[model samples]
Target: MPRLPPVDRLDLDDLVHRYAVLVDQRAFTAVGELFTPDAELVLPDPPTSLRPTVEVRGRDAVIGALGRLTGFAATFHAVVGRVADADPGDPDRATGRVACEAHHVSVDEDGRARDLTWYLHYDDAYARIDDRWLIARRALSVDVIATGPVRKVRADG
Candidate 1:
């Protein structure tokens, strides 16, 4: 098995970071470009909830789901940490875990401003497609979630 090159590792890191930037910019459609055509996104059900998990396949479906973010006034996704490695026997295949925090500001159904933050970790499987690394599968695990009214506090105190 050949060792993974440093350049490939950096490219993987860049791909993870780029997702945050694209999502923050509300470029939902463009997000699909970072994934393979048959990619899948698996999202766990919220803690203590009876809701079913989110499982979506195909690039178009992924883009459509992200487009739902229009409900939020603003959103920011940051990749706080990541660890990835190429498969020892298959250089084109890799696996990784990414820790991220996503903040969303939106107006509730009643019109009040609400702030929601989700701390999550993504377990990812990547594949080198057409000379570029793209996500083939991703499973998101939620660590913590917080919600509250959007408040303004003076910093001059």
Candidate 2:
């Protein structure tokens, strides 16, 4: 297997880290900058949740979906590890696996509060565009999730 240039590897690694930073900062719009115009994102549905798998295509949709995180009172994303390989046939392309943990805090309309954390793994494909590394495709799988240190509401009126 041909090795990727050190600079390319560094740039791609930085790209992965920046996604977490941007999400944690709620700089969702900025997240779009890390992807190609036609990038794709596939997210698995949570266990026992009614929602179907999420598939977002194109940078604009990605930005819109991420921007909705503004509803959360707080969020933090940590990318813990990654393994990447550059394509020998296409030096400008690479693939990797990333592990992450994300915590979210939010309140429902009924005034109940919850804190949730998800352990996730990501499969990613990166491409160089205009000399910048960008995400071309990404699929996230949820390995585990813990929810609710629930703030229960007492019945009284």
Note the clash tally of each candidate.
Answer: 0, 0
Off by over 4 Å in 2: 48-52, 108-113, 148-157
Off by over 4 Å in 1: 1-3, 47-52, 109-111, 152-157
Candidate 1 colliding pairs: none
What is the Cα-based lDDT of residue 129 in candidate 1?
Answer: 87
Superpose all Cα atoms of candidate 1 onto the true structure and report the RMSD in Å to 1 decimal.
4.4
TM-scores for all predictions: 0.86, 0.85
lDDT of 1 by residue, 15-48 (tens): 9999889987878777899999999987766666
Per-candidate Cα lDDT values, in order, are 0.83, 0.82
- Total colliding residue pairs, candidate 2: 0
Give the Å error, residue 59, model 2. Answer: 0.5
- List model 2 lDDT by residue over 67-124, tens digit each: 8777777777899998788898898899988899887778788777687888888899
- Candidate 2 positional error at 45, Å: 2.1
